[model samples]
Target: GAGVSQSPSNKVTEKGKDVELRCDPISGHTALYWYRQSLGQGLEFLIYFQGNSAPDKSGLPSDRFSAERTGGSVSTLTIQRTQQEDSAVYLCASSLGPGVVYGYTFGSGTRLTVV
Candidate 1:
C-alpha cells in the first residue's frame, strides 16, 4: 500500500461481542503501533511491534486487548468482550524504525462503538 490502511472506518458492536481491527502498514516500515483515543482524551498507546522483536504490550489496558503483527507487515488488534468504555477511535501508525526520528504515518482510524 502507498500508505497505512485501516479497515472498517466505523464499527458498532453490541456489548460483549468481540471485534477485530486490521491495519496494513506501508511497505518497508518496521515499526507499527496501536493507540486508543477516548473522547477528549489524548492518545493512549496500546501496543507496538518492531521488526522481529517481541511486541511491547505494556500499554495494553487489559487482558481483553491483544494485538499481533504478521510477517512484520500487517497488524491486527482484537478486543474481547467489548464494553461501552471501549468506545473510542483506534489509531494505527507506522514508522521506518523505532523512535520518532523518522516520523510516523497514521491511518484515519477505526471508530469502535459498543452499545
Candidate 2:
C-alpha cells in the first residue's frame, strides 16, 4: 500500500463483545504505531512496533487490550469485553523508521462504538 490501511472503517459492538482492528503498513516502513482518539480527546498512543525490536505495549489501557505485528508488515489490535468507555477511533500509522524525523503516515482509523 502507498500508505497505512485499516480495515472495517467502522464497528459497532455490544458491551462485552470483542473486536479486532487490522492495519497494513506501507512497504519498507520499519515502524508502526496504534493510537486511539475519543470525541474531544487528543490522540492516545496505544502501541508501537519498530523493526525487529519488541513492541511497546505500555500504553494499552488494560489487559483486555492487545496487539501484534506479523512479518513486520501487518498489525492487529484486539479488544476484549468491550466497554462503552472503549468507544473511540482506532488509528494506525507507519513511518520510514523511528524518531521524529521520519514522521508518520496515518490511516483514517476504525471507529468502534460499544452500545
| TM-score, per-candidate, Cα-based | 0.95, 0.95
lDDT of 1 by residue, 14-111 (tens): 99999999999999999999999999999999888997454588999999998888898989999999999999999999999988697889999999
How accurate locally is residue 85 in candidate 1, as Cα lDDT from 0 to 100?
Answer: 98
Clashes of each: 0, 0
Q: Please list the C-alpha lDDT of all candidates, in the order they appear.
A: 0.92, 0.92
Give the C-alpha lDDT of model 2: 0.92
Residue-wise C-alpha lDDT for candidate 2, range 18-93, written one tens digit per residue: 9999999999998999999999899999999996454588899999998888898998899999999999999999
Give the Cα error of residue 102 in candidate 1, in Å.
2.2
